[model samples]
Target: NLGDALAAETGFKIEMIPLPMKRMGPELISGNISFICYTLEAWLPSVKEQVLWSDVIFNNQNLLVSLGAKPITSLKDLDKKRVGVVVNFYYPNLEDSFNKYQIFRENGPNNESNLQKLLHGRVDYVVLSSLEYQYQKKLQPRLNAYDLGIDTFGVKCAVSKKSPLSVSKINQAIAAMKKSGKLDRIFRLP
Candidate 1:
């Protein structure tokens, strides 16, 4: 939907590709993809060195969720607890505490799997993106969640260093969308 909005606003044709997170960087560097969207700069240090990043398109909220019956209100509560985390993803401010407190991390292939672990009582809590958590709750209303508000970070699109598209152009369209409230409307943001 953002791509569609950007194209409409800028009069530029956009091609959207949905690829596994790990493959996005390789494909971008190889010139197989023009740009990859919805990525965090923190998660792509190497990719940042290789590509041009547009201004933030949106913010991704990183949350620590647990069943409402046993809400995890603070990071200190996770001491020696099992945390379900997505494979290859980084926690913004919790890694050091994990080691110092003996917090056990259970790797899940994706958000859904981590969510499942929490639902089944396999893990004390799971870290998930707020967007993913909302979508899952829509599918299964039984899951109760409490927000940890661990961190919030900007999400940007990465373009090939040699691509014809200018980061400024993309940023312009994104700015227009934000100004017109098109992004908030499309994403149902507050």
Candidate 2:
């Protein structure tokens, strides 16, 4: 994992704290935690404004999922279609277009459920991370996907505004790992 690689590369002990999504920002901003990684700036705008971010750790592409028989390649393809989305996930540039086309937005607990919605024909399409779609597709082997090219977002590691760790130091460590290809190896990056 990138976290483990970062710790080893930096010669620092890193602890993983699993917290509720809403709690992560408040905790980080208050310095209750040292740093948090694998987040999108759009997912936590207020936290982004108050924290230090490392270079992109990875990119998450938001994809459109529909039945293979009826694939959707773009937002315009979603006009008047029922679309499933997980609660609390933001669809950046596509939302306004989805709205303008009067796309029906259905909410699900998570990606799997939205995927199930697509499989069962309960929704016309589902918006999900490409990573998740690929993982699920391998299991089901019947899921369909089309790249929503404009919806790619960067995932970053971030430190608190007043943490003991220096942002530059963390960035340097990440850069070193990148240079040595440790990050690509750990993440199986292409």
Candidate 3:
């Protein structure tokens, strides 16, 4: 949908690629992909010099989820508790706590696996992106989510510096999408 919007807004061809969450940045940096949409600036640390980032496409959050019966009301409640987190994903709010042994991290392949770990008592809580949590919450009514505050992101698009697309063009496309309600249709965002 964003590809369609961008093509329409910018009068240029837009090719969308599906890559693993972790692979998108590297692919963009490696020039294998021209651009990736609806991503976090934090996700493209090394690409700061290699990509032209659009204005925020949207805002998103990462949440800490636990079973309803054993709710974690606050981040401090996670102290000394095992947290199920995705492998290689950054948890800015928990890094120091994990390094200081304040919380224990149990790595999983993805958010779904981490949620399963939480459900099975393998971990006290699981960290998941808002989209994943909302979708999973629909299927598992026994789950609850908590905001860790700093887990929010200004989601944007990154175009490789080599790409013909410019930040201004991409930003205009995003603005057009928001004006037309295309973004809401795509993400059903807050």
Candidate 4:
């Protein structure tokens, strides 16, 4: 849908290329990838000089999720618990907790892998973006999402400096959409 909207506004075909989380930074720095959205600029600090970050697309928060019956309502509830997570992805707010070994991190390849781990009882809890949790909730209604009151950050589009499409052009289209309410409509889409 974003590709369709971008193509309509920019006259260029928007091709999405999927890369492993581990390879994303390297690929972007090497100009082998154009862009990725729903990403945090903080995650790409190593390649900050080689990438262009767009305006904030939306705000998102990190939530602790579990099966409805096993609701984890607060941070204290996570003490010494193993939380499923994406391998190599940083959880900024949890760094201190992780460093102190107060909570354990159980790595998986991606969100789906982590969710599967949770559902299959491989882990007691998992972290998910607010938007992602909402989408997953639609498919599995027996899930509970708990906010830790941390890790709230802006989500934005990250464009490689070597991308064929300039950030300015992309920004113009997004700005237009934001001003005309198209962006809001997209977020509200079922």
What is the lDDT for 116 in model 1? 78
Q: After superposition, how far is residue 14 of candidate 4 from its true place, in Å?
A: 1.9
What tens digits encode model 4's per-residue C-alpha lDDT throughout 122-145? 888889988789889999898898
Name the lDDT value of residue 100 in candidate 1: 76
Candidate of highest TM-score: 4
Candidate 2 lDDT for residue 26: 88
> lDDT by residue for model 1 over 1-71, one digit each (tens)?
77788779878788887776678778888888877667766776667688889899778787777776466
lDDT tens string, model 2, 1-190? 8778878877778898887567778898999988887777787776778888888876778877777756666567777888898766668776776667678878887777887788888998888787777677778787788886848888787788877877787888878877888877765656
Better of 1 and 3 by lDDT: 3
TM-score of 2: 0.84
Model 4 scores a TM of: 0.90
What is each predicted model's overall lDDT from 0 to 1?
0.78, 0.78, 0.80, 0.81
The estimated TM-scores of all candidates read 0.85, 0.84, 0.85, 0.90
lDDT top scorer: 4
Give model 1's TM-score versus the native structure. 0.85
